[model samples]
Target: MSIPVAGRRQLNERHHRAALGLFLVVVIAHWAEHVMQAIQIYALGWPIPEARGVLGLAFPWLVTSEWMHYGYALVMLAGLIMLRAGFTGRSRTWWNIALGLQFWHHVEHLLLLLQALSGTNLAGRPVPTSVVQLLIPRVELHLFYNAVVFAPMVVAMLLHRRPREAERAVMRCDCALRTA
Candidate 1:
């Protein structure tokens, strides 16, 4: 059985806050991994291939798994789309920005996944490469992409929590802080 339209609506109306909290936790955990990977490369002077993040340290294959990366990108995109209705006014606008950026990020991961499966790397490179990766290094490009998407999401959350009177009037979810 599948969720009806009304059930999907309830996700944003009644369950928005909890869902958003869980989504943020996932986002932050992913950020931690990227940050750790960066630290390994820049601070500890570990070579690129040897600098696996926390989970990747134990499961080294995770670093090379295109499917894992694609899955995360898909999850992020889905989360952004699914929770968008909870937002209104300025929050909605910022959320849309984040959604748009995540769509592109998802596309990049899809391209990489395709290449990995096809065994035909972009531009004949041995490994998969994204469109922007042609100009920027993979680590730096992903860090930049995540930061851009996350910045707008944070802005949207802040605005959503402290919504103006008009926004509050339209909100179905109890996500806003109680005003004095």
Candidate 2:
């Protein structure tokens, strides 16, 4: 393909800020979840007062725990709107921020799924689906949670890849490079 002009790429600051803000929000949520989870872990293993539990919910989240994180997911989805804004000459940095947050979020989700599947939460609920319970009818709830929490991320990642190409194309347009 012929190289396009360099100046064709335009970044919209509004969109970029939005995407960046969203990414930061995701980062904060992940950090919060980890912090809360760690406190819970310590509480469960040792004797602590504040870590005793909050909201009357059981210690450590397995299934319903994810449903709680869905609020985090919605925040992420809203943040992706920055991409739409970015497309129309919005900020380029937002794309990178969004990408990083999406990746980290998925990684955490994977870890949590493995934890639940391994039977760490085995005492609390039935393994509704399981390799161990072919005869006993165990069910693995992680299957649903993983799909719900992480699917949009896969789609967003795919979408994020496109603008990167567009930006590259704009750079090749021979337009004066804007010093970021």
lDDT of all the models against the reference? 0.95, 0.41
Report the lDDT tens digits of candidate 2 across residue range 1-180: 422333122323323434444565664555454445446655466333334234324554432454454455445555553334443222334444554655454444444455555755433444222333333321123223334434444344334334444564543222223435
Model 2 bad stretches (over 4 Å):
1-15, 39-66, 81-180
> What's each prediction's TM-score?
0.98, 0.34
- Model 1 lDDT per residue over 56-151, tens place: 999999999999999999999989988998999999999999999999999999999999999999998879999999999999998999999999
In the order shown, the candidates' Cα RMSDs to the true structure are 1.0, 11.9
Model 2 score (lDDT): 0.41
Q: Which number leads on TM-score?
A: 1
In candidate 2 the C-alpha lDDT for residue 158 amounts to 38
Which one wins on lDDT?
A: 1
